[model samples]
Target: MTEQTTGRLKVRLVDGLLILIMAVLAGCGLIYEYLLSHYAGRVLGAVEHAIFATIGIMIVAMGFGAFAARKIKDAFSGFAWLELYICFIGASSILFIAAAIGFTFHLPQLISDTFNLPADVLPRGGWVEQLHQIARYLPYVSAACLGFFIGIEIPLIARVREALYQKHLTHNAGTVYGADYIGAGIGAALWIGWMMSLDINQAAVITASTNLLIGFLILLLFWQKIRWRLLLTACQLLMLAFVIVLSAYGQNWMNSFTDMLYRDQVVLQQQTQYQQIVLTERNLQLNNNPTQTSVLQLYLNGRLQFSSMDERIYHEMLIHPVMASAPKHDSVLLIGGGDGLALREIFKWPVHSVDMVELDPMMISLFKQPRQFLPIRLAKQVIELNANSLSDERLNLMYADAFNQVDQLVAQGRIYDVIVVDLPDPNHPDLNKLYTNHFYTRLQQLLNADGVLVVQSTSPYHAQDAFIAIGKTIADANFSAVEQYHQNVPSFGQWGWSVAVKQGLPVSERLKHSLAAQTMPVIKTQWLTWPIVLASFNFPQGFYKNYVNIKVNRLGSQQLFNYHDQAWRKQQGMVNLNSNQQISP
Candidate 1:
């Protein structure tokens, strides 16, 4: 080949490799951004807010990084260093945040011990509170840093490409920017399609590994022109080794860090496609006895579901009232009670069949499978607590969304004598649909002519507006009768339930009459009895009598979510105010 032809071919090869590097960088950058946001959401409450704020801060920081990239003297060295920095930050971001929060939480106790200050006398607005405030902002700060580093990547790659092809390359910006965009698209696809299935820490390690590989590739391709080639290669190899080590033991570190965040010992923690599931256990020793009283608790997305100590009260109140009042308890449909506690209650009656629809199979498996970490066998504990209801021959479990499953059941001409809506509260916007009038209407259609449906409404005392809105929405769904009741469960104070029947018979009257006739449940209950059920229907004078401003929760309007949010905020405000008052001089 001629010397001129050889030069041209070398330039073309360099150009292609640079473009490919940009694509890889783009994918890895976006993944890092998402990883920080997701981790923040998991650690902090208010997932929606955490995700939005982290992503927003990162995007803006990226712009700053891009603007700052103009100061780079050597594009090759800068890009390689940038990739190394990203790999380090992305791999360790979650660990850093967890450690920061853990430190913040313990700082107060450490200070108290250092100065020998009384725990009760810590200043109301003290260093401890200040540290907490700072901890709250750490996630955003970390996200901005990651975003800024990621932002410089594309600009640096563009400059590197320009230097490589010199006068031969035209439209450098187009080539660089196009590759970045396409690589980002692929990154998103990989994240949603595959990466999300892995544990959060595992996903971070994977992305970091990709970032390190990109750095190595760039160093190899331009080794002849690059300065400090051997040093850079060694650094890249060290980082790769570190990332591999993290992948093997990162989850254990995460669990230990997370355990500090909760009041109880975290026994099992898993990251599912939908949400984070954490199980905590507290063993209370009576008089320092070797035999301890263990309380197993389940939390989803950091919200407490049930504590073994008081779960029976909640489950009994949730299941027995409707089961007793239904005209015929031959067939039942349960939605969202994957723990099998309610199923245990339902199996008390000689029902011919029970169909259950729950969204997360991981939840079911966690409760059903054996685990070495657990103090007791999970399946055996569940069987003992739930009376072996899940293993019943007639129980049919459907791992699917309750909203779509209801439609499917309706289409197949399947109807149930009793329908139990044991779903989580409509604390999130996505859950609003399940509480909407339209969803309740569909549920009503699946009920047999004399069928009864019951929903576990949020606490009437704590979330009065939400409780009233749920009852109003169900009444508006064209059920013949709807009645709201509540029971005091220690785990969840003042929990509520709403029952509806298709025959248009007033549920209160039916329940009152049934109680007067001394009706008893065929199956024994720990906390629920005819008198207790009757008393649950009675609220304090004017408790709900004047709640006329509550809005009906419709599919489009989703008023329940707003009501729920407002009520919880008010409750939290009261709690904070009381706490401050208690600590004041």
Candidate 2:
């Protein structure tokens, strides 16, 4: 080959490698951003807020990183070292955050064990609490560090491309940026398509391993251009070994850390596409003997769904009131009760068919056909707990988001005589949509003219405004009548529900007449009685008097979620209740 031709080919090869490196690094960087955000949401209570905050912090840090990359005098060495740092930080970030949060969570127990102090008697709301609060936010710090390194990548790649060509190419920035954007798009697609459902540690290891491989390629292909070839290669090998170990055992370590966050024994835990499902058991002891009745509690994304001991109270109240009040019980629609506990109650009525729209099919599978991963005894208990309602011949299960599924039912003109919304509290914006007046309005259209619709409103005492707003939203959906009721369930203190009818006598009056006429006797319930049902409709005077500023949860407004989050934070002491700047629950 001629001298000029050889020189041009060399430049082309170097340019291609640099662009490829930029693309791969971009993909890795995007995955790291998602990883940190997802972990933050899992640890923090507010999933949406945590995700947005983490991404925002990372993006701002990236801008600062891009600006700061001008400080690197040796582009080749700087880019290589930056990849190493990114690899180490990305691989270890989640584990480090988990360890910090778990240590802080278990600190009280550690102190009590060391000092022989009673658990409740230990000091609180001091340095320990401060440590807990600080630990909760470690994800943001990790995010900033990772994002800073990721930000330097494109600038270094551009510099290397220019140096390889022996001239500053006008298209350098545009070309490198195009590759980076395309790689990031691919990363996003991978995350949504596959990585989202993988074990989080596994995802981290895979991303880090990709970074390590890219760094190795750079060190090998540009040995003379980059300094510290031997050290970088050694570091690459070491990081590869570390990633392998993490792949083998990191999820176990993560589970141990996660177990520290819970008070009871975490018997079963799974990360599904929708949310984290944790099943915990509290073995009660009376007179130093283990009692036969152990409490099995189900939690979705760290929020308690139900405790087996008092779930009857919650479920009976959620189901029986609306069932009795409805003029007919031949058809029913249930939204978001994948556990089948509510379905078990629905079966008590004389419903000919039940159509359930649950967002998570894994939840349905877990309850319907308990997986072998669950302990055999516990699996049997789960099936028995729900009476295998998921597998019943009357059930027509639709594994889809209720927000969209409700619309389809409306389009099909499929109306239900009774509809039960057994969804979770509106902790995330996606869930907040379900609480909007638009959602309730669509649901109103899906209900028979005289049918009853009931929702599992949040706690009456803990989140009174949120509960009231839910009732108001349903009322605003053009229901003919609406009534709010509460029952003190031990698991969830003072839980509430809202019942509405499209056009008929109100649910409470219908329920009262049903009780008086002896027509509701067919419903055999363990925890529900006539007086309890009737009295649930009664609230302490003035409970409904202070809602002057409450607004109906409209589309995109998320008022119900705001109320619930504010109230919950106040209850958890996360909000400063005594300050003038404090938001009212």
How much does each candidate deviate from the true structure in C-alpha RMSD? Answer: 3.8, 3.1
lDDT per residue as tens, model 2, 1-585:
899999899879877877877877888888898998988887767677889999999999999999999999998898888888888898888988888888887777788899999866764558877787788899999999988888888888888888888797999889999999989988999998899888788899899988888888778777898888888888888888888899899999988888887778999888887777888888875777733656888888777788888899988898988988887889999998899999999998888999999888788888888856577767877888899899899999998989999999999999899999988888788889999999999999998888899998988888889999999999999999999998988766788999999997998898778777887756788878889889989999899896777899999998888998888677767432111011110
Cα misplacement distance, residue 158 of candidate 1 (Å): 2.0
Give the candidate number with the greatest TM-score: 2
lDDT of 1 by residue, 488-575 (tens): 8777788899999998566667767776787754578777776787888988898877567778898878589888877766764455
Query: TM-score per candidate, in order?
Result: 0.91, 0.95
Q: lDDT of candidate 2 vs native? A: 0.85
How many steric overlaps does candidate 1 have? 1
